[model samples]
Target: MSELKAKLFQDLSDAVVDMDEEKTVETSHRVIDEGIDAYEAIEKGLAHGMDRVGELFDQEEYFIPEVLICSDAMYAGVEVLKPHLKGDEQGEKKKVVIGVIEGDTHDIGKNLVKIMLETSGFDVFDLGRDIPPQQFVDKAKEVGAHIIGLSTLMTTTMDGMREVVRILEETNLREQFKVIVGGGPISQSFADKIGADGYAANAADAVRLARKLVS
Candidate 1:
């Protein structure tokens, strides 16, 4: 990468972390003006910042309000770059149904996955926080979604992920959709225990996992 490109990407990342929406918007325009790849900016800059925000959140250095504001800044940058995406970036993409499991009000992880997946050409249906396990199945089936993503930051709500898988098995829809699980309290072992197809550690991995599952 060119030095200018690296610097701009860093600025975009910092803008999001700083919760500076105006700065993100300004940097996004500079990205377009300099012909930096929009997708690259979203991935390396905006998403990267969100990754940092997630870490801070895990450490309790940043709370829900801070994360939401950072997301706003990230979205502000994406809004400017979205329109300039190359034609190949536009397509009839796979569908994903995503939400935080029941008893868990934390939705930041789910939100980041939503943003990243949508930017990567997936049609994402965000069901928001504290969604019942059955609701995830219902929405996924309704949308003909190829993947179901379940998230929760609380250990108490982790069982909801297993319940979703169990429901799919009981309804004989287990084969119809790939179920992916992740959150602060979730791990690969937990995902396997719940019969989830995969576990993604972050937004970028979620996008990669979604692509591989659908492909």
Candidate 2:
């Protein structure tokens, strides 16, 4: 990367980490104006910042409110960059259907995962919070999605994730799409028991796992 492009990437990352939405948006526009690759801006800039935010959250250096604010900044940058993405940058993207499972209204993690996946070049179809298992199956079929990502912050709603896997199996679609699960109460062992293809501990891991599954 050139010195100017390097600086813009750094500025974009810092803007998000600082929770400066306006700066993030402005820098994103600068990225487009300078004819930088939108994909690079998103991966090296916004996603890089969100990765740090995740680390801070893990260390308790940042709490929920701070992470949420940082996410706002990151997403604002994404909005500005999305329209400028070139066709080659978007060609043949993998499709993913993501949602917070039924009886689970908490979606901060799910939203973060969606943003990161989109920025990382996945075709994300967000089914939103409190989605039924059948809805996930239906949407995945509709979109010809390669992966079905289920999330739940509650142990009570975790069963809903299993139901999605079960429904796919019964419909003989289990072989068609990979199923990945995540959230506060989810674990790899639980995922194995529930017959999910993978389990991600957080949003960043979710992106990595999705890539691995597809590749």
Q: Local distance difference test, per candidate?
A: 0.87, 0.88
Put down candidate 2 lDDT per residue, 165-189, tens digits, no spaces: 9999999999999999998889999
Best of the candidates, TM-score: 2
Per-candidate TM-scores read 0.66, 0.84
Q: Which segments of model 1 are wrong by more than 4 Å?
A: 90-95, 100-123, 129-135, 142-146, 150-167, 180-215
lDDT of 1 by residue, 1-106 (tens): 9999999999999999999999999999999999999989988998788777867866879877887798899989989998998887655668999998754455
- Reference-based TM-score, model 2: 0.84
For every candidate in turn, the CA RMSD to the true structure comes to 4.6, 2.5
Error of 1 at 190 (Å): 9.3
